[model samples]
Target: MTQNRRWRRVLIALFVVVIAFTGYHAVRTVSDAIYWNAHRDEPIERWMTIGYVAHSYHVPPHVLHQALNLPPMPDRRPLGRIARESGRSMNQIEAKLKYAIVHARPPYPAPGPPPRPFMPSPSSSSPAK
Candidate 1:
């Protein structure tokens, strides 16, 4: 009976820990979603990387690279580093990113009518009477 009680206590503790862990993450996820949604249109900054800017501003990374005349790749470097390496000012980089964001096309084309379902044509053979 004592062993069973100890096992029960252990299971209860484990269950509590699991619940706490899940609750913490759930709260964090909701808070982050709210924060990002609120700041979705925030301006890009020099400290941000290409991927970060792309995600924050809803602009494609390729558009940003094209605007900045950089090779198409996953550039992990921050904008400040990129500007410094390319001998350009931060303002120039910011301007190019802004332009690209302003002119960036929608990632997907406009939805069109649903495709018609395929139907086999009626056979030329007559049905037996």
Candidate 2:
């Protein structure tokens, strides 16, 4: 009977912890979403991540990373943090990236004619004497 009671207590404790953790995350996500939605009309902050800026402006993530000279990483950190770590002024980086977006260029020039595949000579195809 004691063992059963202890198991029941452990299960209850686990359930409570799970509920608390889930509830905290749910509330945080909703609040953060609301805050960003309200700030949509404002200029993006330096503390905003590159991904956020790119998404807001309809820019491709990879293109933005290339423009900013940033390496591909799992998590996109804020541009402010990036500027500080790279010892560059935020304005400089922002200017270059914004200009790149405005003056976006194609990665390649106009396509040229496809090369023709080489074919074996007719003489050689005669079972090579």
Candidate 3:
């Protein structure tokens, strides 16, 4: 019957659409995976916390803050903000900080003993013999 043919055509069209949608997503997913594999070692550009970057580089947060020339603070902020405030691109800031850490100077010499407090000698209090 004509109604049966119409239903069959509709079903076929719907099947084709579903298959296309699924195939498109599958291709996109594969492409993304390939790109990630190729650039796994590259630095990411999205906003990231200073803590994350320092951790990734195996450097302490305070050390990274000092290396970046950022003012002392209790906690880290987003890298994008840091880069903007410093008038540099996010990538450039990250690169410079990474490079500085890799080539940083050796640690400063150990601190010396604390100075002793002044104490008046027993003989000095009175007249020496």
Candidate lDDT (C-alpha), each: 0.89, 0.77, 0.73
3-98 in candidate 3: lDDT tens per residue? 999999999999999999999999999998887566422463447676666655556667767877876575456778877877888778777777
Any runs in candidate 2 off by more than 4 Å, and if so which?
Answer: 1-42, 104-129
Q: Each candidate: RMSD to true structure? A: 7.4, 12.4, 20.6
lDDT tens per residue, model 1, 5-84: 99999999999999999999999999999988886767778789988888888878999999999999999999999999
User: For model 1, how big is the CA root-mean-square deviation?
Assistant: 7.4
* Best candidate according to lDDT: 1
Give lDDT for model 1: 0.89
The 10 consecutive residues of candidate 3 with the worst lDDT sum are 37-46
Per-residue lDDT for 48-125 in model 2, tens only? 787787667666767767777777653378888888887888897788677766666445577899999999989888
Model 3 spans > 4 angstroms off: 43-81, 87-92, 99-129
Where does candidate 2 have its weakest 10-residue lDDT segment?
36-45
- The model with the greater lDDT, 2 or 3, is 2
Per-residue error for 94 in candidate 2, Å, reads: 1.4
**Model 2 global lDDT (CA atoms, 0 to 1):** 0.77
